[model samples]
Target chain A: MTEKDLIDACKRKNRQAQRLLYDRFSPVMMGVCRRYIKDPMEAEDVLVEGFFKVLTKIGMYNGDGSFEGWIRRIIINEALMHLRKNNQFKYAEEINPNLDYTEEPTVLDEIAAEEILNLLDEMPPGYRAVFNLYVVEGYKHREIADELGISINTSKSQLILAKQRMEELVKKRLGRHEI
Target chain B: MKTEKNISTLFQKGAERISVQPSGQAWQRLESRLEKEERRGRVVVMRWVASAAAMLVLVAAIWLWSASMQQHNFAILDAAPPQNLEDLENVDGCEPYCLVLKARAELPAYYANPVEKRN
Candidate 1:
């Protein structure tokens, strides 16, 4: 069935249609959730909640944008809410201005998705959240500030700190020849 | 050393390409929650319908009662009193005979017979 047809059936609360939609989108959405949530189980929880919302609130989709993009936004918001509930954004105001940028430039292309996620896991929650919001999610510093309840400068600092920490992680990984 | 932007871009691209299937039981968990939510939604709708039905019943009952009361009042007004009773209503300190006359004027003849105590 076409996406429109599937969406229509799901809106009608058709179980078959709901299953089809979940089967189609859950993997990618789980990946999206995982970027923000370190725990696989928590990421799965967010994914499930996100899909539930996507199905239940499908009527609000006005066809103004890509359906996948709409789903992505919902998943991202769910992940953010999970983070907020866990107080991951609490330290967003602790700005460290003296971030080190001296690490030798490692080839980013050489790292796998798992390694990137591992690097993210090593960073503080606030730094990781800011980095994901600003970089992966493409939110501007102002938007990130609004989302994390921090100032724009804090968002910027957090992103810088996240990157510095990622570089250190990558350098250590390179030393171990894991890449 | 890779610049922050490069790393960010790399991470974004890599994350986009990666895919991991959910655990086998994940779908079951989600389906169960959806069913629970659906049940809750149905309960809300049922409650609303029941409330509306009760309100409609109350309004109908009130309407029927008021209509019956109006019909009874109209029947009383339509019943013509004896012509002399209009004048009797103005009588002051109604004497027993006047009261008997007023009863005779307001009630039908068959009912009024009991009011006549004087010869």
Candidate 2:
């Protein structure tokens, strides 16, 4: 059945429909979960909780943007929740916004997803979380600020610094002349 | 199929994604939760009903109490009360009244006040 068809059936609370919906979305949502967190088990746990929240709040999905976007948001929140539960969010002192990261766009495209995740793993929990959330999910600075309990300026400066740090590491890993 | 394929690759790189196996366990748990929720719904309704009943009883009791108090007050007003004869005769001599003598009773007392008594 088409996704819309499945969603319609799920809205009616059909058991088969609910199960089918979960099967289709869980894997990708799980991937999204893993990005901000390290442990597979905890990521899976968040995925389950996120999926449950989505199921309960599905009626709130107004079909304005994307259904995937809606679910992606729930998974991101779940990851943040897990981070908070484990006391893993590290809030760095605010960096000066003037720090230059002009060439990050080209540098970012060159790095593999795996290497990025590795650098993310090494990041202080707070910085890594803000970085992944802003860069990967395309969340706005205001959004990161609101979610992470930091200011918009803080989010921007952090993203800039995270990119600068990630670039340095990627250059170190790939050697300077390769790119 | 590029979009679908991209999604598949992204998922594959992360780990083996759990193919959603429809375990009866999931349904069973859902059913139990829903049942519990249903029970909670009933309990909420029952609570509202109980509150409404309590409010109604309180209103009724207050109404009866006020009505009884009004009736008692009316009874006091409807029956007679003692008034000073001097004042009573001086103003309006409308009702028969009696008072115990404060001192020795004088045989007969009569007066015609020329000035209006300031009430």
Can you give the TM-score per candidate against the true fold? 0.78, 0.60
lDDT (tens digit, per residue) of candidate 2 on A1-179: 98788778877667688777777787677667766777766767677677777776777877788898888888788899889889986666778877764643322213455654565566667767776776567678888989987789888888776666655665566554322
Model 2's CAPRI class is incorrect
Fraction of true contacts kept, per model? Answer: 0.37, 0.02
Candidate DockQ values, in order, are 0.25, 0.04
Off by over 4 Å in 2: A104-113, A174-179, B1-119
User: Which of the numbered candidates is closest to the native, going by highest lDDT?
Assistant: 1
CA lDDT scores, all candidates in order: 0.79, 0.66
Q: Identify the candidate with maximal TM-score.
A: 1
Writing each residue's lDDT as its tens digit, candidate 1 over B1-119 gives: 43333566667777665566888778888899999999999999999999999999999999999999999989966977434645556555546647777666667876746566787
True contacts kept of 2: 0.02
Clashing pairs in 1: A104-B1, A105-B1, A105-B2, A106-B2
